[model samples]
Structures are given as C-alpha cells and as structure tokens.
Target: MTYTHILTRPVRFFGFAALAALLAAIIFAGAAFGTTVFAAPIERTDVLIGFKNIPGFAEHTLVRAHGGAVTKSFHLVPAVAASLPSAAIRALERNPLVSVVEIDGEFTAIGHSVELDNTWGVAHVGAGSVHHDSVVGTGIKVAIIDTGIDYTHSDLGANYAGGHDFVNGDNDPMDDNGHGTHVAGTAAALLNGAGVVGAAPEARLYGLKVLNASGSGSFSDVIAALQWAVDNGVSVTNNSYGSSRDPGTLVQAAFDNSAAAGVLHIAAAGNEGNCPGNRNTVGYPARYASVVAVAATDKNDKRPCFSSTGPDVELSAPGVSITSTYLGGSYATGSGTSMASPHVAGVAALVMAAGEQSASAVRQILRDTAKPLGDSNHYGHGLIQAVAAVAAVGDSSPPPDDSEPEPEPEPAPEEPTDEPDTTTAVVSDISYSTSGGRTNDRHLTVAITISNGDGAPIGGATVSIDLHRNGSRIASGTGTTNSSGVVSFTLKNAQTGCYSTTVTDVVAEGAQWDGFTPSNEFCK
Candidate 1:
C-alpha cells in the first residue's frame, strides 16, 4: 500500500507587478500623480527591517511613507517589525538605511500530542536529588516563551510571577494553547502535594506568549518576547518553539543580544531527526550558538527517532510520554524535543539557585557534569545532571564551619635545635585583563603572582582566589602556581560592573603565608 505525504510549505509572495500596481493606485489615489483607479487586491505581509544604525523617528517615518505600519520597535537591535505591501519590500531593500528586509519567519510549539501518564523525567535527570539539597530554583526567574501559560493552574499559580502576551497584545498571558503550560509545568510547577511537581518547582515562571492558540507565531513576536524577558530580569528562558528554516539575522541578533544580557536560553532541537544516518536537522534559534539545544530521550535513555540530532544538540532529556501540566489546570503527557528543552531549562534554574549566577557558568557546569550518553550528536554532553551540576556550584563555595573552635593551648617552649626556617609565601602582585569581542564572550582574567620574602618567585604554591562583582563573591577557585609563580582565574561572560579579586589563601609544603591583604579591584 502507498502512503500520501502532505507537507506544509512556507508562505510565498506572487504577482509582484499586480501588487505594485495596487500599492501605486492606493498611494496615488486622489493625488497629483493620478486619479483614483481600482486595481487587483494585494495581501500585506509581516516583515522585519534591520537598520544599519539605531532606528529612530526618521526610520519610522520612512516605513510609514512606504504604506507600512510599524508594530514593534527594538532598542537592543536596530530593527523594527512592520506590516507592508509585498511590493514595498524591494523599495525598503534598496534604501541605504535598511540593511535587511526579510519576511518574519513563522515558528510553532514543538510537541507531539500524547496520552497522559506519570512523569519520569525529573528523576531521570536527577532533579529530585537536587531538591533534597534545597536547590529547587528558588528566586530564579524563568521565562516560558511560547503559548501563554495557565497562570490560574494550581500547579503553577503561586510561581507564576507575571508576563506579556504578544499574541493578543495584552498583559494577561493566559495559555490559549496547552503547549506553553506544559512546558512551564515541566520547568517549574508548584510543589503542592496534590499534583505533579516540576524540575525547578520553586522557580518563578513568566509566561511570554509568542505563539497563539494554534501553537504558531512569527519571529517578530518571538523577538519582542525575548526583549521583554531581558528587560524584566528573566535569568533563564525556555524556548520550546522553532522552525526548520533559519529565522534570519534579525531574530538571531535578538537571541544573541538577550543571551549577552545574562539570559540563558534553552530550546528544543526540533523533532526532525533521521535515525538511519547522522544528519544536521537542528532548528533555529536553537541552532544559534547562544542557545542550548536539547534533544529528546526515552525512559531507557535512548534517543527517539523524532529528536533532531546534530553537533548543536547540547543535552538530552526524557521527552517520551512525559506528563506535565496542561490547560484548564489539567495534566497531560507529550513528547518531542519540546518536553526535553524544559528539563534543561529547569536544571539551569536549579544551577542558578545553587549560587551559580553567570549564565555562562551555569552552561559550563551543565555541560561538564552531564552523563556521557554515547554520541555527541545524539546527546551533546549527555543527559543533564542537575544534582551534579548543582553540586559543582556548591563545591565552589566555602563549606560552613559550624563546630565550636577549640580552646587555645599555652605555647610550648621554642626548640633549641631547629631543622630549618619555614619559607614564607606572599602575594606580590595582582593584575587583570578583559578579552573577547562580543559581550557574552567577554571575560575577566586575573593573574596573581606569588613570591617569597626575598622577592623571589615561589612556584608549587596552591593559591585560592575569590572573585567578587559588586561587592558579592561570584566565584572562587584554587590553582597551583606554575614555574612563573603565577595563577590566573577567569570569570566567564562578565557583565558591565565593578569586579575585584583577592587571594584568600596560599599553601605550600613547609611554607607559611605572609600577613598581608592581597587583593585588586577594577571596573569594566
């Protein structure tokens, strides 16, 4: 028996001459150019216009003059989203101020409808163990950028902070489609005893409604949602939506800028995998370097045939028959990379709540601690290990000293015969440098030099450094001094702020530390 395949094609423009005539007739009607004349009707298309420089009043006026209506204006990127006659696209492309004019690409909530069941993803990713350590993503803000969320759901109501709706252009981002609510529940459902709990149960949820009731939306709306998320202090964003085709440079820039602003974007790796061979089928914006692309796995920790695979797949999570919150305060199960993406996003929130604030730091920890699940294309780092990732963060901080100090003993008499005097190590100097071209890539590297009392380099010394930003300790690391008596500490993805580094401790065999305040501070 033969099967019929019905594939959906992207919207295309046609009849350019007729469209031009229609626009001309509308513009020149009742004007000096010509008298009013009827022409063939033309369809308006939504587009994203990228400018060479910061767009302002002149740019807005230019779009208006071309019979275009500006819908969204962005400050992070020099662009404006508008609806205009298809004929005006050529005119805008020819303008010196307009660098790019592309149709706003469409994306959909990527999830396969399935029957409801018990959720095993949380335990599979070790989120349960993380919760035992009190890292339930408390105080971490996660933006669910998809269909709006059911904020009234008992499983998500309390943690639902607030959000914006790009679909209806309203403040209430109530989930019209069940996909966003499901994604939000996977990332952060409440810890109420009656129902299911999320990976980061305590994480604050912000529903940024980009997709509509049909689980479809345009790239321009997604960009607007991203900007809103960044401006509203969202630390992590769960994007379970994307298209197989590229969304263009404008959308890429929006995601990049949002990531640079300290938001960790976790997205689905599109459910378009070909199991017979290794293929590059990952979707954007997940394909972008700035976002973490997650693949879907089954309960047996095996990659599903539908889960897209490529080098961009950063992590894999339980996506098959994963049960989560649905619309109308109900619970449902779904499958796809969509279910997998939120597992990573929730793990990210757990990492942040465990004291890892930097988006890059959280990403590195997730990658470094993931379980090795065979191929990189199938599992990037592997299944995300929330317990291990959060433990890594805990490892960086000093353990609490709760035991009472022992009473000081009387000093013993100095020994008449001594083997040799203990060598004293001192922090001679501290310096720092900034590197990387992009904001998110930029980091702060601090070099600390250790020396002896005679000003000689002291190698083989273990130096502990604490990095602080805005007066709070952000990171701490210990390294052995090399032959040059220097050890460097780097803070990845450093934001614009004041930073300082201090040598907290130094240890060497048969060596003592010289009593001195060794620290340096700088602003970047």
Candidate 2:
C-alpha cells in the first residue's frame, strides 16, 4: 500500500533522559554557586546509515560522540538504525566509513475495511484441491512482517511459532491493529473445522510487528524486522506494507542480503491503480528486484481500481472482500494489494512444502504455473494456481490409472560423444567507474567480463545490461564482448546517485552461459 507522507517532526535524542538528568544536576550546582545554567534542546532525526564495512564498537562510539544513538545494529547488511542531529547527517555521510545516509521513511498497512464475507481466495487459486491432495504447506516457516498477529486467535494459535515486536521493542508481538491477524489467517490459518482456513493451513507463522497499532512505522523498524527474519531461519516473509517512495540503498541492501540468505520476500504492489493501468505504481520493497510484487484481483479475476499495476508486478491473487481471522479472536474482511500478497506467500509455502525449497526455484515454479490473464500490466502471469504449482514439482498424487492396453516400449536414442557441443560461460566480474562532478556532466561506465568455468575468457559473447539508479532501471544496452572478454556500457550525463548494472543475459555460439553471482556498484 502507498504510505502516508513521512513523519518530519523533529525528535529528541535517544539519550534525552540522561541528558535531562545531567542538566538538572548542573542547574542545582549553578544555583548553589549563585549562577544559572541552560542546555539547548537537540533536534534529532531517525535515519538508516549504510556502512562501507560492517560497523563495530568504534563506529558506534563515533555516532555517540556526534550526539547520535544507535537504536538497532544489523549484522548481515552492514548498517545501523540511529537517531542523530539533523545537522550531523551531513557529517556522517562525509565519514569515510559511511556509504549512505537516508531518513527512515514511514510505511503502513495497505488494506481497508470491507463487508464480512467467505474466504473465496483459497478455492479461487486452486488451493482447495491441493489441500485435498494432502499437501498443505507442512513444515514451512512463513513470517508475517506487519502490524503484528493475534496468535491467541484459535485459527492462528496452532501455527504461531513465535515473533518479535520491533515497534514496542519486546517479545510480545500481539496485533492491536487487525490487519496483520487477517493477513496471517489468509496465509496460514489452522484447519480446525471452525473458522476459515488458510491457503497453506499447516505452514508455521512468525509474527514480526514492524508497524504499530495505527498501522504505520519507520523504515528502520522494517529493516530490523527483515534482519530478524533472516537471522531466525525464516523461509518466506509476507510484507503487506510499503511506501511509494524509494527507501534508499539501505533497505534494498537488506532485502538483497536476505534473499541471498534464502528468504523469499513477497509484498503488495500498492493500492495506487489506474483505470488505464499504464503507470508503474509498484511500491518498495516490492519494487526491489529481490522481492515478488503481487497485484490484487477480484473473484471474477478482474483487476480492481485500487490494485496497482506495473512491470514489477509478478503475480496476482484474490484480494477483494476476503474474510479472515482478526484481533480478539474474531474475523474481518479487508481489501487491498495487502490481501493479495499473503495469498502468493501461502502458495509459496505450499510449493516449498511440496519439495521445492529453494527461494528462486519456488519463484520460478509459481510463475511457470500461474493461470495467464491478458495484459501483463494488470495481471502479471495471471492468478497463482496452487495445485498446478505443487503438481509441477511432482508432489500431488495423480489420478488412479484405469484399464488400458499394454503398449511396446519405445527404442532408446543413441548416446552422444563424450566431448562435444558448447562450453559453460559465466560472468567473471562486474565493475563500475565514474567521471565528472557537475550534475549534467557526470558519466558512469560499467564493465562486465565473461569467462568459462576454468577462468578462460569467452570472447564474442553477447552481453546485455540493465542500468539502474536509485532502484529503478533507467537504461539498458547490449553488446558483444571483445576478444579480451570485456563489455563496457557507458551512460552519459548520468545523475549523481546510487547506480548499479545487472547482466540480464549472456549468449555465445559455442558456450553455454551459466548464471553468475549478482552484485551492485554505486557511483555516489
């Protein structure tokens, strides 16, 4: 969902209590000495700081010396969430150890109230048949990163493993707001024969409360929650909250790192749809390349006015008036891309439980088996079909074979020569270089090298690159590699900001292109 505008009000430093106590002591001492002492209030801003290297005690001490307090420190992403004086931000950005400094933007739950109704999404997405086949997402961990989950709810308690409350900084992640509970129910509610069941009724649920009762929270909290998910061995994360604004390199880095660690992230595309559906309205971290952006559809498989459409949207699911478990052991119906995301997540769990555990493999299986609807903008690969996806991995039971005539076995084909055909080619390295300082005069060049498995250069390979700045693809180019196995693409008049180049494809006549490890490079 599109977040409300970020909160810009000045905040007091995290050490304000200690500072006040010191001020009181100074005032008493000054009065005894027949003098008055005063301390100016420090106006701080919540920010996420990215480090060139993983931060340690020295870096934290530096922040404290500059009147900043570390709220959270991350291990995998090399970043820290802290509150610093507005004037100190520039100093930190200029620090040799710091890579980027950005204000922590706000994100919120995307769903709105709707009339109570039956849970039609499970059957609509073919989960009912899959459930009947006895593959109900058993032994899979799906983390719900939102307001929180009402684990005490009868339908969800059985699946609730445990959770952390980032908003309240505690272990109890109870949902004062109903959004997370409803979302959790749709993803992994229990099949206890009373209330509505989830798409993957047996998947374990972990509640990570990033947002508060008002359904809004800062980017720092979301990042910390994601880090927690990655650290705790979560298989998949259902992020039904987002902001239209780009959350800068720190958030993207967290998602990419988590994805690299085998955590599949699914998020809402947004509620900013249009009648024509021509605009790209997907929100971050959904817009990030590491996440699967989900679009919302109705019972008739029609895109709703509020469901955002974009190239980033990878899958669509039922979101309109879907009822699920709510706070206080109740149920509620809501509508938004938020409702659509958990459907995909639950199906993802089902596929994972059905013997496809790799995050990338599950993503491709879901895409390959989705029911296609016209217009990729409105419906990316159409609706997700749980049975087809599960069956694709050979997990579902086939129908019993009836009486049939025996047939002769076909002859086997001849074996090929031991050594022939193409050699395997892979991207050896990708590097970035920049020139010029003025806004309109800046230029960026990306060089990619391809080589074989033995590290020999693969010449004449066609390489394609997508140039991204600030998380959006701005330009793309294709060129053949030189005899030295290097292909360089330059963007003239590139704006000064975070830049990255991804090798979309590599082709050669006598060499098969094996996938390479992907990484990002920045010019700023």
Candidate 3:
C-alpha cells in the first residue's frame, strides 16, 4: 500500500518549486516501490529495510543509491519500512544510513502453552478480582490469528466477531483445526453456563485464520492478519504462533506498524523448552521488538519443560494443562508457549477495559506491576498478575520524586570562616562484614572512625547509614561520632539463605573535614 503524509517543517518558507520537487520525489519513491515480493516459500530473495532520522527526500535518494527496489513501506512506524533484493540488502546493511536490515521470511504457527486445580490459570493472574469490578473486558477486542476459531462454540460464540480466513482465501474464518478455538477461549471465552470463564470474560474475539488444520502457515499470511488487525481497530491480538530460526523479514515492519497504530500484538515466546540446551533461544515474530513475548508458567509458578526462555521473553503466565473451549463447542486441555500467550492477551484487554487506551501505556502498567520473581530468564520480570495490572492502569500515585538526582559531592566552601582552625579528618579505620546466622537471625556490621589531619581521633561528627535490601530501601539510622570519632550501624535480622541481598549504598559523613563514599558499593 502507498502512504502519503504531509509532514510539517521548520518556520522557514520554501519556494513553491522546491516544495513541489520534494513532493514529486516522494510520490515517485512510493510508486517505484509499491508492492513486496508476494511469492510463497521465498526467503533470502526479499529483505525488509528500516531507516530513521532521514527526511523523505533523503530516504528516496538512499534507497535508489543502493540499487534497492522498494516494495512497500509503513510510514507510520519509526523506521521507514521497505523491501529490497538480496544484493541491495547487503549494500543497505553496509551503509551507515540504514538503521536495520532483516531478511524477509515466512512464519509457521508454532503449536504450543495455567491453574485453579481446574482453573488455576485464571486465579494465577488474579483475573477474578478484576471481574468483581465489572471490568470483564466489556469493550475490548482481541484477534486470534491462529488455525481458526470455532465461533459456534457455546463458550466462545457470544464474544466471537467476524474475521478473515487467509488459509482458504475466504472471510468466514472457521476452525478446520482446534488450535485457534483453544487459544481464543483462553483469551476471552464468554461467561456462560456450563463452560470455563476466560481471563477477560467479556472481551471480544475474532479469528483471523492463518494456520490450517496441520497448525502451520507462511509469513505472508501472518502479515495479512496483522494488516487486518490494523485496519479493523483491533485492541489486542493473541498470536500463539512462531517460526524457529526465521530471520526477521517483512513481518517485522508489520509488527512495528501494528504497535504504532495503537494495537498490542501478544505472541508465544516459543515451546522449544531447552531445545537450544542452556541458551535462551527465542523464535521469530515473538522475538521482534513490537511483539509482547510471553513465556509459560504452571500453577506453582514454575517454568514448564517446553516453554522457551530468554531476554526477549517479556512476561510469563499459566500455560500448563490449561482448559478452554475446543471443537464441537466443547472444552479441552492443552499446553505450550501458545497457551501462555493468551493469558497476557486477556490481561491486555482487561487493562484496556479499565480505561488504558494507549498500547504502550498498557504494556508499561503490566511490566511495572508484574510479580517480581528473582529469575528473569524463565519468568521475564515474573508472572503476570491481572488485579495488579488493572490497579496499575488506574493508578493515581504521586508522581515519582524525580526532582532529586543522586546527591553530588559538595564543593569546598568558597568563603573562609573567621574561626578557621585548620583541621582535616580522614577515616582512620573502616570495616564491614555479614554475621553468620540462620535465615531467621542474621546481621550486617558496618563501622567507621574519623581522625584529625594530625592523626588524632576526632569527635562529635554526625554519622548516618542507609541500608538497602534487594534493590529496595529497608533501613536507615543516624549515629553520633563518639569521643573516639567512631560510629557503627548493624542491621539485625538480615536475610539468609537464597538470593540474599548484600548490604549496599553505605555512606559516611563528617563535619566537612573529609567526606567518604565507601569503596564497597557496586552501583550500576
């Protein structure tokens, strides 16, 4: 598709002819590169290119300069997205002007991934509390871009809307396979008699059928689904799919465009649990910047054997033995990164129903309020909690006290005092250590002494200490320097066993004879 944007420039008048030339250049550029290589099973032949900070004219010139043929571009996204031949891709990658170059490839649906013994997954994320407030995703819409959804299912039909079937090139989007209906149920199955309640029970669902009965589809179908979401004003898209080792291609631009257009794209982080064996290997689309990559967790908040782990994994949700709507308007249980993805997608809708409209804003609220577990790889910032996420969406806390940057060292007084008796105090001694004890009773010891410039002990200096436990402030106290110029702070009941937070940010103060920032601090 061709896009025209009338960007405003600085407060300078351009001659009519100069403005005309720029417009004509952009028009020619759009026409010259108006369609991507639409062939199936074609990789390495088409490439997706992105450019940033370059003006429209400059982008046009740069593409042509590298012999790059433009197919299509999503001007709404930060990077000017385009397609190029293999040779142009190499040249573009080598060029300083291009921001990112990725090979355009296809994506296949990766079949993959919660609890109350029967519905623990719903309680795991606290969606019940959100439902109590009537925030059951009443006004939100989530698209399931999978095999297809059985809209006829008693549990899902109430919320099911119309969607396109990319597999058969039709608009009916019915389920030939059961995967889409299963994922759809997890995302937003309706609250009806004799069925499981979804994470966001009232959220709308649409099946943008991409995968066929065998649970697979090409990259182009994925792109078409994304375009459909963008055009249809979809609030969230639950994509329980992926492509292993697929270099990012045309779909990357599509993901970016979808996000920029205010839609959230949630995807399974992949189910190759330890397939790379000790390395966190995330697959394509899910690993893209614009997609919310979700990992899988169980009732006990543990990573299952099949869920992938990596830095790209954003958040985790219940995905083990999950029960949801199925074929024949029935319900069944399944697992995979695919199952894990819908939990987050449902939460996204709940957050939206609570009045968070911006896609970026909803993402931040979810990340900020997620259950913070120590392990990031398995549970990317920890398991997602729906009640917390909902509360965060409507949070009106006092804005953070960003006014205080870390205190800088004070400069020596410029004005000399009349009672100047030259005295400089140095830390005569310093020591710190952790006391051995069981988890219930441990302590931290920090000590410091002040001495005069002449090597004599100083006295009466106010001493203060700040103690932190696990990245949060835990304790602080002030001590007066004794006659011997010594002051100490001991934190009792220090935590022992399992990820102990070491005492950090210990600072000492004197009467300005000398200031000290201890060396033990490893502030990042």
Per-residue lDDT of model 1, residues 442-519, tens digit only: 867778788876677777776655577899766655566777788766555677788876554565554555323344
State which candidate, 2 or 3, has the greater lDDT. Answer: 2
Clashing pairs in 1: 148-175
Candidate 2 residue pairs in backbone clash: none
Tell me how candidate 1 scores on lDDT: 0.79
TM-score, one value per model: 0.69, 0.70, 0.58
Candidate 2: count of backbone clashes, pairs at least 3 residues apart or interchain = 0
lDDT of 3 at 389: 86
Per TM-score, the best of the predicted structures is 2
Candidate 1: give its CA RMSD in angstroms: 24.5
lDDT of 2: 0.79
TM-score of 2: 0.70
Q: Clashes per prediction?
A: 1, 0, 18
lDDT of 2 at 213: 92
Compute the lDDT of residue 52 as modeled in candidate 2.
84
